[model samples]
Target: MTLPLFPLNTVLFPGCRLDLQIFEARYVDMIGRCMKTDSGFGVVAIVEGDEVGSAPGEFARTGCEARIRDWQQRPNGMLGIRVEGGRRFRVSSAQVQPDQLTVAEVEWLDDQPEKPLTVEHDDLATLLGALSLHPMVASLEMGGEVKGQQDLACQLAYLLPFGLAQKQVLLEMDDPTVRLARIQVLLEQLQGDLTA
Candidate 1:
Protein backbone atom coordinates (compact mmCIF):
# COMPACT_ATOMS: atom_id res chain seq x y z
CA MET A 1 0.00 0.00 0.00
CA THR A 2 1.07 3.59 -0.55
CA LEU A 3 1.14 6.11 2.32
CA PRO A 4 1.99 9.74 2.97
CA LEU A 5 5.60 9.72 4.19
CA PHE A 6 6.85 11.69 7.19
CA PRO A 7 10.60 11.42 7.61
CA LEU A 8 12.32 12.42 10.82
CA ASN A 9 15.78 12.17 12.34
CA THR A 10 14.56 9.47 14.75
CA VAL A 11 13.75 5.82 13.95
CA LEU A 12 10.74 3.96 15.33
CA PHE A 13 10.12 0.23 15.61
CA PRO A 14 6.87 -1.66 15.79
CA GLY A 15 5.16 -1.80 19.21
CA CYS A 16 7.10 1.25 20.33
CA ARG A 17 5.79 4.70 21.17
CA LEU A 18 6.72 8.21 20.07
CA ASP A 19 5.56 11.71 20.95
CA LEU A 20 5.82 14.44 18.33
CA GLN A 21 5.01 18.13 18.09
CA ILE A 22 3.18 18.90 14.85
CA PHE A 23 4.08 22.55 14.38
CA GLU A 24 5.37 22.44 10.80
CA ALA A 25 2.78 23.73 8.38
CA ARG A 26 3.02 20.73 6.07
CA TYR A 27 2.80 18.19 8.92
CA VAL A 28 0.00 20.07 10.63
CA ASP A 29 -1.97 19.61 7.45
CA MET A 30 -0.90 15.96 7.27
CA ILE A 31 -2.02 15.32 10.85
CA GLY A 32 -5.38 16.93 10.16
CA ARG A 33 -5.80 14.79 7.03
CA CYS A 34 -4.91 11.59 8.92
CA MET A 35 -7.30 12.47 11.72
CA LYS A 36 -10.04 13.08 9.23
CA THR A 37 -9.62 9.63 7.75
CA ASP A 38 -7.77 6.58 9.15
CA SER A 39 -5.81 8.24 11.98
CA GLY A 40 -2.50 6.74 10.87
CA PHE A 41 0.83 8.05 9.59
CA GLY A 42 4.01 6.68 8.04
CA VAL A 43 7.24 7.45 9.89
CA VAL A 44 10.49 7.02 7.97
CA ALA A 45 14.04 7.49 9.21
CA ILE A 46 15.42 10.57 7.50
CA VAL A 47 18.47 10.07 5.33
CA GLU A 48 18.60 13.63 4.04
CA GLY A 49 16.44 16.55 3.04
CA ASP A 50 13.58 18.19 4.94
CA GLU A 51 10.68 16.24 3.46
CA VAL A 52 10.01 12.97 1.69
CA GLY A 53 11.05 13.36 -1.95
CA SER A 54 10.14 11.72 -5.26
CA ALA A 55 13.27 9.63 -5.72
CA PRO A 56 12.37 5.98 -5.05
CA GLY A 57 15.79 5.03 -3.71
CA GLU A 58 16.35 8.16 -1.66
CA PHE A 59 14.55 7.55 1.66
CA ALA A 60 15.42 4.87 4.17
CA ARG A 61 13.89 1.55 3.12
CA THR A 62 12.51 0.63 6.54
CA GLY A 63 10.01 2.57 8.69
CA CYS A 64 7.09 2.15 11.07
CA GLU A 65 3.39 2.57 10.34
CA ALA A 66 2.15 4.57 13.31
CA ARG A 67 -1.25 5.52 14.74
CA ILE A 68 -2.05 8.68 16.64
CA ARG A 69 -3.00 7.41 20.09
CA ASP A 70 -3.72 10.87 21.49
CA TRP A 71 -3.70 14.46 20.27
CA GLN A 72 -3.59 17.71 22.21
CA GLN A 73 -3.75 21.29 21.06
CA ARG A 74 -0.74 22.97 22.60
CA PRO A 75 -0.83 26.43 24.13
CA ASN A 76 1.24 27.68 21.17
CA GLY A 77 -1.58 26.56 18.81
CA MET A 78 0.33 23.59 17.35
CA LEU A 79 -0.66 19.99 17.95
CA GLY A 80 1.01 17.58 20.35
CA ILE A 81 0.55 14.01 19.22
CA ARG A 82 1.37 10.72 20.93
CA VAL A 83 1.78 8.04 18.32
CA GLU A 84 1.81 4.30 18.90
CA GLY A 85 4.05 2.39 16.55
CA GLY A 86 2.16 -0.30 14.66
CA ARG A 87 4.23 -2.16 12.09
CA ARG A 88 7.45 -1.87 10.13
CA PHE A 89 7.33 -0.97 6.43
CA ARG A 90 9.69 -0.26 3.58
CA VAL A 91 9.14 2.63 1.21
CA SER A 92 9.10 1.42 -2.38
CA SER A 93 8.53 4.85 -3.90
CA ALA A 94 6.85 8.13 -3.10
CA GLN A 95 5.17 11.09 -4.78
CA VAL A 96 3.44 14.23 -3.62
CA GLN A 97 -0.32 14.01 -3.60
CA PRO A 98 -2.56 17.01 -4.34
CA ASP A 99 -3.43 17.38 -0.63
CA GLN A 100 0.22 18.30 0.12
CA LEU A 101 1.21 14.96 1.69
CA THR A 102 3.82 12.73 0.03
CA VAL A 103 2.52 9.25 -0.71
CA ALA A 104 4.85 6.23 -0.63
CA GLU A 105 4.49 2.77 -2.09
CA VAL A 106 5.25 0.51 0.85
CA GLU A 107 5.48 -3.14 1.93
CA TRP A 108 4.95 -3.79 5.64
CA LEU A 109 7.39 -6.00 7.51
CA ASP A 110 6.11 -9.02 9.41
CA ASP A 111 6.44 -9.43 13.14
CA GLN A 112 9.45 -11.45 14.21
CA PRO A 113 8.94 -14.70 16.10
CA GLU A 114 9.44 -14.89 19.83
CA LYS A 115 12.68 -16.69 20.52
CA PRO A 116 13.71 -18.59 23.63
CA LEU A 117 17.04 -16.93 24.00
CA THR A 118 19.05 -17.79 27.11
CA VAL A 119 18.60 -14.47 28.86
CA GLU A 120 19.24 -13.82 32.46
CA HIS A 121 16.34 -11.60 33.48
CA ASP A 122 18.76 -10.33 36.07
CA ASP A 123 20.47 -8.28 33.37
CA LEU A 124 17.29 -6.37 32.75
CA ALA A 125 16.62 -6.00 36.44
CA THR A 126 20.11 -4.64 36.96
CA LEU A 127 19.63 -2.08 34.21
CA LEU A 128 16.26 -0.84 35.40
CA GLY A 129 17.47 -0.62 38.94
CA ALA A 130 20.38 1.49 37.78
CA LEU A 131 18.20 3.69 35.62
CA SER A 132 15.89 4.35 38.54
CA LEU A 133 18.83 5.86 40.34
CA HIS A 134 19.36 8.51 37.71
CA PRO A 135 18.14 11.90 38.91
CA MET A 136 16.28 12.70 35.71
CA VAL A 137 14.42 9.40 35.50
CA ALA A 138 13.72 9.47 39.22
CA SER A 139 12.26 12.95 38.97
CA LEU A 140 9.94 11.74 36.24
CA GLU A 141 8.77 8.77 38.39
CA MET A 142 9.58 6.19 35.68
CA GLY A 143 11.45 4.05 38.16
CA GLY A 144 8.96 1.61 39.64
CA GLU A 145 6.58 1.01 36.78
CA VAL A 146 6.74 -2.48 35.30
CA LYS A 147 7.54 -2.37 31.61
CA GLY A 148 7.44 -5.56 29.56
CA GLN A 149 10.74 -6.88 28.27
CA GLN A 150 10.31 -5.71 24.69
CA ASP A 151 8.85 -2.37 25.70
CA LEU A 152 11.55 -1.89 28.30
CA ALA A 153 14.26 -2.46 25.72
CA CYS A 154 12.73 -0.08 23.20
CA GLN A 155 11.99 2.59 25.80
CA LEU A 156 15.53 2.47 27.15
CA ALA A 157 16.95 2.68 23.65
CA TYR A 158 14.75 5.66 22.95
CA LEU A 159 15.54 7.49 26.19
CA LEU A 160 19.26 6.86 26.20
CA PRO A 161 21.20 9.75 24.71
CA PHE A 162 22.72 7.35 22.21
CA GLY A 163 24.11 8.40 18.86
CA LEU A 164 22.33 8.09 15.53
CA ALA A 165 24.51 5.12 14.62
CA GLN A 166 23.27 3.19 17.65
CA LYS A 167 19.67 4.04 16.87
CA GLN A 168 20.12 2.90 13.27
CA VAL A 169 21.49 -0.37 14.59
CA LEU A 170 18.35 -0.93 16.66
CA LEU A 171 16.13 -0.08 13.69
CA GLU A 172 17.97 -2.43 11.31
CA MET A 173 17.68 -5.42 13.62
CA ASP A 174 14.69 -7.50 12.50
CA ASP A 175 14.70 -10.19 15.13
CA PRO A 176 13.44 -9.47 18.63
CA THR A 177 16.08 -11.77 20.09
CA VAL A 178 18.84 -9.80 18.43
CA ARG A 179 17.30 -6.52 19.46
CA LEU A 180 17.14 -7.74 23.04
CA ALA A 181 20.77 -8.77 22.82
CA ARG A 182 21.75 -5.32 21.63
CA ILE A 183 19.77 -3.76 24.44
CA GLN A 184 21.55 -6.01 26.88
CA VAL A 185 24.88 -4.76 25.60
CA LEU A 186 23.77 -1.16 25.89
CA LEU A 187 22.54 -1.74 29.39
CA GLU A 188 25.80 -3.34 30.33
CA GLN A 189 27.64 -0.35 28.95
CA LEU A 190 25.49 2.01 30.94
CA GLN A 191 26.04 -0.06 34.09
CA GLY A 192 29.79 0.04 33.51
CA ASP A 193 29.68 3.79 33.17
CA LEU A 194 27.88 4.10 36.48
CA THR A 195 30.51 2.01 38.25
CA ALA A 196 33.34 4.02 36.68
Candidate 2:
Protein backbone atom coordinates (compact mmCIF):
# COMPACT_ATOMS: atom_id res chain seq x y z
CA MET A 1 0.00 0.00 0.00
CA THR A 2 1.04 3.60 -0.56
CA LEU A 3 1.64 5.69 2.56
CA PRO A 4 2.68 9.24 3.33
CA LEU A 5 5.81 9.14 5.45
CA PHE A 6 6.72 11.32 8.41
CA PRO A 7 10.39 10.81 9.18
CA LEU A 8 11.27 11.81 12.72
CA ASN A 9 14.16 11.14 15.08
CA THR A 10 12.13 8.62 17.07
CA VAL A 11 10.59 5.21 16.59
CA LEU A 12 6.91 4.38 17.11
CA PHE A 13 5.61 1.00 18.21
CA PRO A 14 2.20 -0.56 17.89
CA GLY A 15 -0.21 0.19 20.72
CA CYS A 16 1.81 3.23 21.76
CA ARG A 17 0.77 6.87 21.80
CA LEU A 18 2.61 9.90 20.45
CA ASP A 19 1.58 13.53 20.48
CA LEU A 20 2.77 15.64 17.59
CA GLN A 21 2.80 19.35 16.98
CA ILE A 22 2.01 20.22 13.40
CA PHE A 23 3.17 23.51 11.93
CA GLU A 24 5.00 22.90 8.69
CA ALA A 25 2.78 23.39 5.66
CA ARG A 26 3.58 19.96 4.24
CA TYR A 27 2.74 18.11 7.46
CA VAL A 28 -0.22 20.31 8.33
CA ASP A 29 -1.69 19.54 4.96
CA MET A 30 -0.87 15.86 5.39
CA ILE A 31 -2.55 15.73 8.78
CA GLY A 32 -5.58 17.52 7.41
CA ARG A 33 -5.88 15.04 4.57
CA CYS A 34 -5.44 12.07 6.90
CA MET A 35 -8.10 13.34 9.30
CA LYS A 36 -10.49 14.05 6.49
CA THR A 37 -10.09 10.62 4.99
CA ASP A 38 -9.86 8.84 8.35
CA SER A 39 -6.68 7.22 7.15
CA GLY A 40 -3.30 6.88 8.80
CA PHE A 41 0.28 7.77 7.89
CA GLY A 42 3.61 6.02 8.24
CA VAL A 43 6.11 7.33 10.83
CA VAL A 44 9.64 6.29 9.92
CA ALA A 45 12.68 6.98 12.07
CA ILE A 46 15.21 9.36 10.54
CA VAL A 47 18.61 7.77 10.28
CA GLU A 48 19.97 11.15 9.22
CA GLY A 49 18.83 14.77 8.80
CA ASP A 50 16.47 17.02 10.72
CA GLU A 51 12.74 16.71 11.29
CA VAL A 52 11.92 20.13 9.85
CA GLY A 53 12.60 21.74 6.47
CA SER A 54 13.68 19.52 3.59
CA ALA A 55 13.34 15.75 3.34
CA PRO A 56 15.39 13.62 5.64
CA GLY A 57 18.72 12.43 4.22
CA GLU A 58 17.72 8.85 5.07
CA PHE A 59 15.24 6.97 7.24
CA ALA A 60 14.65 3.43 8.38
CA ARG A 61 12.55 1.37 6.00
CA THR A 62 10.58 -0.08 8.88
CA GLY A 63 7.99 2.08 10.62
CA CYS A 64 4.66 2.09 12.38
CA GLU A 65 1.34 3.32 11.09
CA ALA A 66 -0.01 6.29 13.07
CA ARG A 67 -3.77 6.69 13.42
CA ILE A 68 -5.03 10.04 14.64
CA ARG A 69 -7.10 9.76 17.79
CA ASP A 70 -7.60 13.38 18.84
CA TRP A 71 -6.72 16.81 17.52
CA GLN A 72 -6.93 20.43 18.57
CA GLN A 73 -5.70 23.81 17.50
CA ARG A 74 -3.27 25.05 20.12
CA PRO A 75 -3.21 28.61 21.39
CA ASN A 76 0.36 28.81 20.18
CA GLY A 77 -0.98 28.70 16.62
CA MET A 78 -0.03 25.10 16.02
CA LEU A 79 -2.10 21.98 15.50
CA GLY A 80 -1.78 19.39 18.22
CA ILE A 81 -2.73 15.81 17.56
CA ARG A 82 -2.69 12.61 19.54
CA VAL A 83 -1.99 9.49 17.56
CA GLU A 84 -1.95 5.81 18.39
CA GLY A 85 0.44 3.48 16.69
CA GLY A 86 -1.40 0.80 14.72
CA ARG A 87 0.66 -1.54 12.55
CA ARG A 88 4.24 -2.08 11.45
CA PHE A 89 5.26 -1.74 7.82
CA ARG A 90 8.35 -1.74 5.63
CA VAL A 91 8.82 0.79 2.88
CA SER A 92 9.70 -0.71 -0.50
CA SER A 93 10.34 2.57 -2.23
CA ALA A 94 9.90 6.25 -1.40
CA GLN A 95 10.17 9.64 -3.04
CA VAL A 96 9.86 13.27 -2.06
CA GLN A 97 7.08 15.30 -3.60
CA PRO A 98 7.26 18.93 -4.70
CA ASP A 99 6.04 19.96 -1.26
CA GLN A 100 8.83 17.87 0.28
CA LEU A 101 6.43 15.33 1.70
CA THR A 102 7.81 11.81 1.53
CA VAL A 103 5.49 9.16 0.17
CA ALA A 104 6.22 5.46 -0.09
CA GLU A 105 4.91 2.08 -1.16
CA VAL A 106 4.94 -0.03 1.96
CA GLU A 107 4.20 -3.63 2.91
CA TRP A 108 2.56 -4.27 6.25
CA LEU A 109 4.52 -6.52 8.53
CA ASP A 110 2.89 -9.81 9.45
CA ASP A 111 1.08 -9.68 12.75
CA GLN A 112 2.36 -11.96 15.44
CA PRO A 113 -0.36 -13.83 17.22
CA GLU A 114 -0.91 -12.46 20.69
CA LYS A 115 0.92 -14.42 23.37
CA PRO A 116 0.26 -14.24 27.11
CA LEU A 117 2.98 -12.72 29.26
CA THR A 118 5.15 -15.44 30.69
CA VAL A 119 6.55 -15.43 34.21
CA GLU A 120 9.79 -14.16 32.72
CA HIS A 121 8.01 -11.02 31.60
CA ASP A 122 6.79 -10.08 35.08
CA ASP A 123 9.85 -7.98 35.89
CA LEU A 124 9.55 -6.10 32.64
CA ALA A 125 5.87 -5.58 33.25
CA THR A 126 6.66 -4.24 36.68
CA LEU A 127 9.20 -1.92 35.16
CA LEU A 128 6.51 -0.69 32.79
CA GLY A 129 4.13 -0.19 35.70
CA ALA A 130 6.72 1.92 37.47
CA LEU A 131 7.35 3.87 34.29
CA SER A 132 3.64 4.67 34.05
CA LEU A 133 3.82 6.54 37.35
CA HIS A 134 6.18 9.22 36.08
CA PRO A 135 4.34 12.42 35.17
CA MET A 136 5.63 12.52 31.63
CA VAL A 137 4.76 8.89 30.97
CA ALA A 138 1.39 9.33 32.64
CA SER A 139 0.65 12.18 30.26
CA LEU A 140 1.05 9.86 27.31
CA GLU A 141 -1.90 7.82 28.61
CA MET A 142 -0.39 4.50 27.48
CA GLY A 143 -3.18 2.76 29.33
CA GLY A 144 -3.48 1.05 32.71
CA GLU A 145 -2.56 -2.58 32.17
CA VAL A 146 -0.37 -4.81 30.10
CA LYS A 147 -2.57 -6.96 27.90
CA GLY A 148 -0.11 -9.41 26.36
CA GLN A 149 3.48 -9.99 25.37
CA GLN A 150 3.31 -7.75 22.34
CA ASP A 151 1.63 -5.03 24.36
CA LEU A 152 4.18 -5.22 27.13
CA ALA A 153 7.12 -5.22 24.73
CA CYS A 154 5.78 -2.32 22.70
CA GLN A 155 5.04 -0.18 25.74
CA LEU A 156 8.46 -0.71 27.30
CA ALA A 157 10.27 -0.24 24.00
CA TYR A 158 8.35 2.96 23.36
CA LEU A 159 8.90 4.45 26.81
CA LEU A 160 12.55 3.55 27.36
CA PRO A 161 15.50 5.82 26.52
CA PHE A 162 16.95 3.31 24.07
CA GLY A 163 18.63 4.72 20.97
CA LEU A 164 16.74 5.14 17.70
CA ALA A 165 18.50 2.18 16.10
CA GLN A 166 17.75 -0.02 19.06
CA LYS A 167 14.10 0.93 19.00
CA GLN A 168 14.01 0.37 15.27
CA VAL A 169 15.25 -3.17 15.81
CA LEU A 170 12.47 -3.78 18.29
CA LEU A 171 9.95 -2.35 15.85
CA GLU A 172 11.09 -4.65 13.08
CA MET A 173 10.97 -7.84 15.12
CA ASP A 174 7.95 -10.02 14.45
CA ASP A 175 8.25 -12.26 17.47
CA PRO A 176 7.14 -10.96 20.84
CA THR A 177 9.25 -13.48 22.74
CA VAL A 178 12.42 -12.49 20.90
CA ARG A 179 11.58 -8.82 21.19
CA LEU A 180 11.12 -9.16 24.94
CA ALA A 181 14.39 -11.07 25.21
CA ARG A 182 16.24 -8.32 23.37
CA ILE A 183 14.66 -5.78 25.66
CA GLN A 184 15.85 -7.76 28.65
CA VAL A 185 19.38 -7.70 27.31
CA LEU A 186 19.19 -3.98 26.68
CA LEU A 187 17.85 -3.40 30.16
CA GLU A 188 20.69 -5.42 31.61
CA GLN A 189 23.18 -3.36 29.65
CA LEU A 190 21.53 -0.21 30.93
CA GLN A 191 21.75 -1.47 34.49
CA GLY A 192 25.39 -2.37 34.00
CA ASP A 193 26.11 1.10 32.67
CA LEU A 194 24.34 2.66 35.59
CA THR A 195 26.29 0.62 38.14
CA ALA A 196 29.61 1.40 36.49
Candidate 3:
Protein backbone atom coordinates (compact mmCIF):
# COMPACT_ATOMS: atom_id res chain seq x y z
CA MET A 1 0.00 0.00 0.00
CA THR A 2 1.05 3.59 -0.55
CA LEU A 3 1.63 5.19 2.83
CA PRO A 4 2.11 8.79 3.86
CA LEU A 5 5.41 8.71 5.71
CA PHE A 6 6.36 10.49 8.91
CA PRO A 7 10.09 10.05 9.43
CA LEU A 8 11.60 10.76 12.82
CA ASN A 9 14.81 9.88 14.58
CA THR A 10 12.66 7.91 17.02
CA VAL A 11 11.19 4.50 16.25
CA LEU A 12 7.64 3.24 16.81
CA PHE A 13 6.72 -0.41 17.36
CA PRO A 14 3.50 -2.34 17.02
CA GLY A 15 1.09 -2.38 19.96
CA CYS A 16 2.54 0.97 20.96
CA ARG A 17 0.89 4.38 21.02
CA LEU A 18 2.18 7.63 19.64
CA ASP A 19 0.92 11.18 20.06
CA LEU A 20 1.80 13.68 17.37
CA GLN A 21 0.88 17.30 16.77
CA ILE A 22 0.51 18.05 13.08
CA PHE A 23 2.02 21.46 12.46
CA GLU A 24 3.79 20.99 9.14
CA ALA A 25 1.77 21.94 6.07
CA ARG A 26 2.54 18.66 4.38
CA TYR A 27 1.44 16.61 7.39
CA VAL A 28 -1.74 18.62 7.84
CA ASP A 29 -2.76 17.45 4.38
CA MET A 30 -1.50 13.96 5.11
CA ILE A 31 -3.63 13.73 8.24
CA GLY A 32 -6.67 14.98 6.35
CA ARG A 33 -6.11 12.39 3.65
CA CYS A 34 -5.67 9.60 6.20
CA MET A 35 -8.86 10.68 7.92
CA LYS A 36 -10.60 10.38 4.58
CA THR A 37 -9.18 6.93 3.82
CA ASP A 38 -10.03 3.66 5.50
CA SER A 39 -6.44 2.78 6.38
CA GLY A 40 -4.00 5.37 7.69
CA PHE A 41 -0.23 5.97 7.37
CA GLY A 42 3.29 4.97 8.39
CA VAL A 43 6.15 6.22 10.57
CA VAL A 44 9.82 5.20 10.05
CA ALA A 45 12.73 5.78 12.34
CA ILE A 46 15.06 8.38 10.89
CA VAL A 47 18.46 6.85 11.38
CA GLU A 48 20.79 9.69 10.52
CA GLY A 49 18.83 12.91 10.78
CA ASP A 50 18.38 14.98 13.91
CA GLU A 51 14.59 14.89 14.00
CA VAL A 52 11.52 15.25 11.82
CA GLY A 53 11.90 16.91 8.38
CA SER A 54 15.68 16.92 8.53
CA ALA A 55 16.33 14.79 5.40
CA PRO A 56 15.37 11.69 3.51
CA GLY A 57 17.49 8.51 3.12
CA GLU A 58 18.22 8.96 6.80
CA PHE A 59 15.39 6.79 8.12
CA ALA A 60 15.49 3.14 9.04
CA ARG A 61 14.05 0.66 6.54
CA THR A 62 11.61 -0.89 8.99
CA GLY A 63 8.82 1.03 10.75
CA CYS A 64 5.41 0.61 12.29
CA GLU A 65 2.20 1.17 10.35
CA ALA A 66 -0.19 3.34 12.29
CA ARG A 67 -3.89 4.15 12.26
CA ILE A 68 -5.52 7.16 13.80
CA ARG A 69 -6.97 6.02 17.10
CA ASP A 70 -8.20 9.48 18.08
CA TRP A 71 -7.71 13.09 17.11
CA GLN A 72 -8.98 16.62 17.56
CA GLN A 73 -8.52 19.78 15.57
CA ARG A 74 -6.23 22.21 17.27
CA PRO A 75 -6.76 25.98 17.39
CA ASN A 76 -3.87 26.44 14.95
CA GLY A 77 -5.67 24.47 12.22
CA MET A 78 -3.50 21.44 12.83
CA LEU A 79 -4.36 18.02 14.20
CA GLY A 80 -3.70 16.61 17.62
CA ILE A 81 -3.67 12.96 16.68
CA ARG A 82 -3.17 9.80 18.67
CA VAL A 83 -1.82 6.92 16.58
CA GLU A 84 -2.01 3.32 17.68
CA GLY A 85 0.90 1.37 16.33
CA GLY A 86 -0.14 -1.57 14.20
CA ARG A 87 2.20 -3.75 12.10
CA ARG A 88 5.82 -3.26 11.23
CA PHE A 89 6.80 -2.68 7.59
CA ARG A 90 9.82 -2.01 5.49
CA VAL A 91 9.89 0.94 3.13
CA SER A 92 10.67 -0.28 -0.40
CA SER A 93 10.95 3.18 -1.84
CA ALA A 94 9.73 6.70 -1.27
CA GLN A 95 8.61 9.41 -3.66
CA VAL A 96 7.79 13.05 -3.12
CA GLN A 97 4.11 13.36 -3.90
CA PRO A 98 2.03 16.26 -5.20
CA ASP A 99 1.08 17.86 -1.90
CA GLN A 100 4.63 17.76 -0.49
CA LEU A 101 3.81 14.46 1.15
CA THR A 102 6.14 11.48 0.86
CA VAL A 103 4.53 8.32 -0.46
CA ALA A 104 6.32 5.14 0.44
CA GLU A 105 5.85 1.72 -1.11
CA VAL A 106 6.01 -0.61 1.85
CA GLU A 107 6.33 -4.36 2.50
CA TRP A 108 4.59 -5.34 5.71
CA LEU A 109 6.06 -7.58 8.39
CA ASP A 110 3.94 -10.08 10.35
CA ASP A 111 5.68 -11.76 13.23
CA GLN A 112 3.54 -11.46 16.32
CA PRO A 113 5.20 -13.35 19.13
CA GLU A 114 2.89 -13.86 22.07
CA LYS A 115 4.95 -14.88 25.02
CA PRO A 116 3.06 -14.90 28.28
CA LEU A 117 4.38 -12.49 30.87
CA THR A 118 6.06 -13.93 33.94
CA VAL A 119 7.01 -12.28 37.20
CA GLU A 120 10.57 -13.46 36.77
CA HIS A 121 10.78 -11.91 33.30
CA ASP A 122 9.21 -8.65 34.40
CA ASP A 123 10.81 -7.09 37.43
CA LEU A 124 9.91 -3.81 35.72
CA ALA A 125 6.25 -4.41 36.47
CA THR A 126 6.49 -3.74 40.18
CA LEU A 127 8.22 -0.40 39.71
CA LEU A 128 6.00 0.48 36.75
CA GLY A 129 2.92 -0.44 38.78
CA ALA A 130 4.05 1.89 41.52
CA LEU A 131 5.06 4.60 39.10
CA SER A 132 1.74 4.25 37.29
CA LEU A 133 0.13 5.51 40.48
CA HIS A 134 2.18 8.70 40.53
CA PRO A 135 0.46 11.85 39.33
CA MET A 136 3.13 12.28 36.69
CA VAL A 137 2.59 8.77 35.33
CA ALA A 138 -1.18 8.36 35.67
CA SER A 139 -1.98 9.76 32.24
CA LEU A 140 -0.12 6.87 30.63
CA GLU A 141 -1.75 4.09 32.57
CA MET A 142 -5.18 4.89 31.21
CA GLY A 143 -7.68 2.53 29.55
CA GLY A 144 -6.62 -0.91 30.71
CA GLU A 145 -5.87 -3.48 33.36
CA VAL A 146 -2.43 -3.29 34.97
CA LYS A 147 -1.57 -6.90 34.14
CA GLY A 148 -0.49 -6.41 30.52
CA GLN A 149 3.31 -6.26 30.50
CA GLN A 150 3.54 -5.41 26.81
CA ASP A 151 1.21 -2.47 27.33
CA LEU A 152 3.10 -1.59 30.48
CA ALA A 153 6.40 -1.57 28.61
CA CYS A 154 5.03 0.53 25.79
CA GLN A 155 3.37 2.97 28.16
CA LEU A 156 6.43 3.32 30.36
CA ALA A 157 8.71 3.61 27.33
CA TYR A 158 6.64 6.50 26.07
CA LEU A 159 5.62 8.09 29.34
CA LEU A 160 8.75 7.79 31.44
CA PRO A 161 10.90 10.89 31.70
CA PHE A 162 13.63 9.30 29.61
CA GLY A 163 15.55 11.11 26.94
CA LEU A 164 15.03 10.46 23.24
CA ALA A 165 18.25 8.48 23.14
CA GLN A 166 16.92 5.93 25.62
CA LYS A 167 13.61 5.67 23.76
CA GLN A 168 15.43 5.22 20.49
CA VAL A 169 17.25 2.31 22.05
CA LEU A 170 13.97 0.71 23.04
CA LEU A 171 12.54 1.37 19.62
CA GLU A 172 15.42 -0.07 17.64
CA MET A 173 15.55 -3.29 19.58
CA ASP A 174 13.46 -5.71 17.52
CA ASP A 175 13.27 -8.33 20.24
CA PRO A 176 10.46 -7.42 22.61
CA THR A 177 11.84 -9.56 25.42
CA VAL A 178 15.22 -7.89 25.28
CA ARG A 179 13.63 -4.48 25.20
CA LEU A 180 11.62 -5.27 28.31
CA ALA A 181 14.70 -6.53 30.07
CA ARG A 182 16.59 -3.37 29.26
CA ILE A 183 13.69 -1.26 30.39
CA GLN A 184 13.66 -3.20 33.65
CA VAL A 185 17.29 -2.31 34.21
CA LEU A 186 16.67 1.31 33.32
CA LEU A 187 13.69 1.54 35.63
CA GLU A 188 15.67 -0.01 38.47
CA GLN A 189 18.40 2.54 38.01
CA LEU A 190 15.89 5.33 37.81
CA GLN A 191 14.17 4.19 40.98
CA GLY A 192 17.46 3.93 42.78
CA ASP A 193 18.42 7.40 41.69
CA LEU A 194 15.10 8.80 42.79
CA THR A 195 15.38 7.21 46.22
CA ALA A 196 18.98 8.29 46.65
TM values, all candidates: 0.75, 0.98, 0.75
Better of 2 and 3 by TM-score: 2
TM-score of 2: 0.98
lDDT of 1: 0.70
Per-residue lDDT for 66-139 in model 1, tens only? Answer: 89878898898879987877777777877866655668888877765544424565566566668878887665
Q: In model 1, what is the error at residue 46, expressed in angstroms?
A: 1.5
Judged by lDDT relative to the true structure, which candidate is superior, 2 or 3? 2
lDDT score, candidate 2 = 0.94
Top candidate, metric TM-score: 2
The 10-residue segment with the lowest total lDDT in model 1:
50-59
Compared with the true structure, what per-residue lDDT tens digits does model 2 show for residues 1-196? 9999999989999999999999999999999999999999999999989999999999999999999999999999999999999999999999999999999999999978899988888899989989999988899987469889999999999999998899999999999999999999999999999999
Q: Best to worst by lDDT, what's the order?
A: 2, 3, 1
Residue range with the least summed lDDT across 10 consecutive positions in model 2: 138-147
TM-score: model 3 vs. ground truth? 0.75
